[model samples]
Target: MEVYSEKQQIRAAIDALKSKNLTLGLVPTMGALHDGHLQLVKKALANNDKVVVSVFVNPTQFDNNEDLVKYPRTLEKDIALLKTVSRNDILVYTPTIEDIYEGNTVSENFDFDGLEFEMEGKFRHGHFDGVGTIVKRFFEIVKPHQAYFGEKDFQQLAIIKKLVEKHDIPITIVGCKIHREANGLAMSSRNTRLKPEYKKAAPFIFKTLKTAKELFGTKSANKIIEWVEKQFANHDLLELEYIIIADTETLKPVKRKSNQKSYRAFIAVYADDIRLIDNIALN
Candidate 1:
């Protein structure tokens, strides 16, 4: 329940916890709490003795300024939900733009170049670099034994793992499952932005991806993408961003192979102005 805006105070508190030899876990978030974020908390709490959930909205991560401006922030309700989840010993850090970036500061560059410009990377240029920088800073400040991320953002999970290894951040990256809603749409705070009609129609993205999963063994990559594209094409509310079949680990497009190396189906769609991302690992 204790909130620490100052880095020194937060570190001091972490130091006190470390003195007792309790395990430290960090769950970095952007405030707006949902079942997906809670799933991460549950995983972290189960693994470590002391769980610190960070609630800072890093401006650098958003490729679109309007999207950044519209990103939700509901700290009071979020904290109340955290308490209900039995996560009271949280070290919430909410930093000002100046606190994160000082006086027109030049940020350090991370070499995610090739990895940066593909799929969502191609869609959101320099987005992962922004994610890398903020996450690196969090790792340094919290010095947690482990950091948790949700697998819904499978690509982000992959990037952060590499970032930790490349930078020698000394923290283990743990990924929890992709949480979902009753209708099968991936639970996201942005789901709140969708209109009632669009919300019901939104689950079609998951259905399309799931249908692609069902057709994986029988169909080729191009066939699968086309089928998924057609499904979304008919839905007026849903605007297809990128639909691709790729190797789950590499995120490279999957070629038509009879061997079946377990491809992944990922789709990013915009229902009206609200963007929602979801994916399914082909069986």
Candidate 2:
């Protein structure tokens, strides 16, 4: 695997590959490599002739400075993990912040067509705008034929699909399945930061979602949400943030059963101060 910290060098390398008629795939990520991220790389390797994995902790995306500062950055270990996942020739782009945002970096406002108004968008202000800016930059720089993103960030995946359509970028956006631990917790880089005791209780987030799914057909959305909140209420280690049943497409909160469209349960929880998010289909 070859690693390039400069954009120009990576662009030149990709250009060289394109000269040989190779199709390129991109898997953009923040640097703390985990099994979830490797799954994305595995899919990219299977589909494209060449794959480029970007490992930059984008500062623009973080609304909280502390979260940004505390976000994991094990570049050496991350590269080592990537090496284990793919023996095929791979390019790792690890650009510096200045390399990505050379001059005045203004966060561009994105109209996600009402997709950004609830859940993550409502909670973290300007989070998706920052997501949009960096992703757009990467698309421009990498110019891959296909890009892979994990479904773990379900809402983000939807917004990115909108971003691609809004710009008319000539690339296919592929959403891969969410990778989870044996215990049912969605695999995330932030899982590494959880305290040992909190880690053990973390899987309850998914457990609760599963229960919510089972109760969907019989119970009202309000009733199901109430039960989910009550399940987390007594747990001192787990604090429920928000839980809602919403249409899968519009992401608008659903109050009643709809025969026309599918719905899902979206959730966010703070397990001992470490925030984790998960969602499950309720159809």
Candidate 3:
């Protein structure tokens, strides 16, 4: 597998493959490699002639400086993990901060319709703008036929879809299923920071979501939200941040279930300083 740090060289390498009429798939990631990320790579490899997996931890995406500093970086381990995925030369792009941000590192402002004003956006100001900026940059740099993203970041996935639609970017955005641990906790790079006991309690987040899903049609959305709030309220280790039952398309919180629209239960929890988010479809 050929690993590259420079954008120009990476683009040249991709262009070489494209010259032979090879189809390309791109999987953009912040490094701390795990099975969840590899699943994305596996999906990309299955679909395209070649794949480019980027492992740059984007600074613009983090609203909290501490979270940014504390965020794990395992480039060597990441490369080793990528190697285990396939014998095929997966083009691994690990750009430096200077490569991605150049001199001005400020995030570009984007209007994600009203989608930016809810959930993660409300909590992390300018977060989606960073996401939109970096993602758009990757689209420009990689120029792949199709790009893969996991559905774990459901809101981000929606924003990206909106981005592609609004800009008319010529690429298919494939949302893969959320990868989870045996305990049902959603996989995240931040999972690395969880303390031992917090890690043990982490699976409760998914369990609560599952229970909430079961209560969906029987109870009102607001009632279910109350119940979930209570569940996390009583938990010693995990603290609930926000929970919303929203229409899948618009992401506006719904008071009651509608047969006409699909809905999902989205939740954010904090195990001390480490934040974890998870969602489940409640159709």
Candidate 4:
């Protein structure tokens, strides 16, 4: 249940834990806790001798001023949720802007040219760079043997995996399952901002993804896209952003599959300006 706000304290804490030969696990978060985030913590707890959950709201990831201004911040409630799970949990230090980025001499930014321009990245300019920069910093500070991320952010998970591999950081990255509500909408902090009616309809995203899965191999990529598009068009509140049926791993839009049987259907939409994203695997 210990909370720290200084780098020196973080170093000392990790150093002390390392002295005891503990296998450390790091769960990086942005301060608002939900079932999805807790699943990550639970995984880290199971996999390591000690688990550290960081509650820093990284400033660099937001693409809009309004989004940043409106992003939820419930540090006390978040901390309480973590503490209730376990008092022995390691909470990482959260540095202020002055502490994190001191001057023009901050660590070099990730290139992220290819990674940043796909999926959510294409929509949010410099978003992956912000994700990459802070993730790199978090790993550098925590130095955990392993890290856990949610599948809800599948693309971000993919980018972070590539980041670790490219940098040769000695850590295992694990992607946990996406947590969902009874109605099937993926749990996210942003879900809080949705209007009451739109909140109820949010589960339709997952349902549409389910529909994509059911219709996957029966038709060509274009056919699948058309069918999904029509389904989305039926919902007046859900405005389709993009519906892409692409390669399972590469994420490139698939025109024709030669031997690639596996596919992923990624979609984005706005329900009264609250952007929602989701993807499903189909083979």
Per-residue accuracy of model 2 over 1-283 as CA lDDT, tens digit each: 8999999999999999999999999999998999999999999989999899999988878888899999999999999999997756689999988899997566788999999887899999999999999999999999999999988898999999999999999999999988999999999999999999999999999999999999987999999999999999988799998998889899999977878999989999998768999999878
* Per-residue accuracy of model 1 over 152-262 as CA lDDT, tens digit each: 888888889989878777899998888999989999989888889999898888888877888987888898888878887888788999997777656788775535466
Q: What is the C-alpha lDDT of each candidate?
A: 0.83, 0.91, 0.93, 0.82
* Whole-model lDDT, model 2: 0.91
Best by TM-score: 3
TM-score of model 1 vs. true structure: 0.95
The prediction achieving the highest lDDT against the true structure is 3
Candidate 1 deviant stretches above 4 angstroms: 105-107, 258-260
Q: What's the residue-level lDDT of 70 in candidate 3?
A: 90
In model 3, what is the error at residue 95, expressed in angstroms? 0.8
lDDT by residue (60-153, candidate 4, tens digit) is: 8887868878888988888878876778766756677666666532335675436657778768877887888888888898899999998778
Give the per-residue Cα lDDT of candidate 1 at 150: 88
Clashing residue pairs in all predictions, respectively, total 0, 0, 0, 0
How high is the lDDT of residue 82 in model 3? 93
Report the C-alpha lDDT of model 3 over 1-283, residue by residue, as the tens digit: 8999999999999999999999999999999989999999999999999999999888899999999999999999999999999757599999988998898898998988989888898899899999999999999999999999999999999999999999999999999999999999999999988999999999999999999999986899999999999998898888999999999999999965678999999999999899999999998
Q: Order candidates by TM-score, high to low.
A: 3, 2, 1, 4
In candidate 4, the residue pairs with backbone N, CA or C atoms under 3 Å apart (3 or more residues apart, or in different chains) clash, namely none
Q: TM-scores of the models, in the given order?
A: 0.95, 0.98, 0.99, 0.94
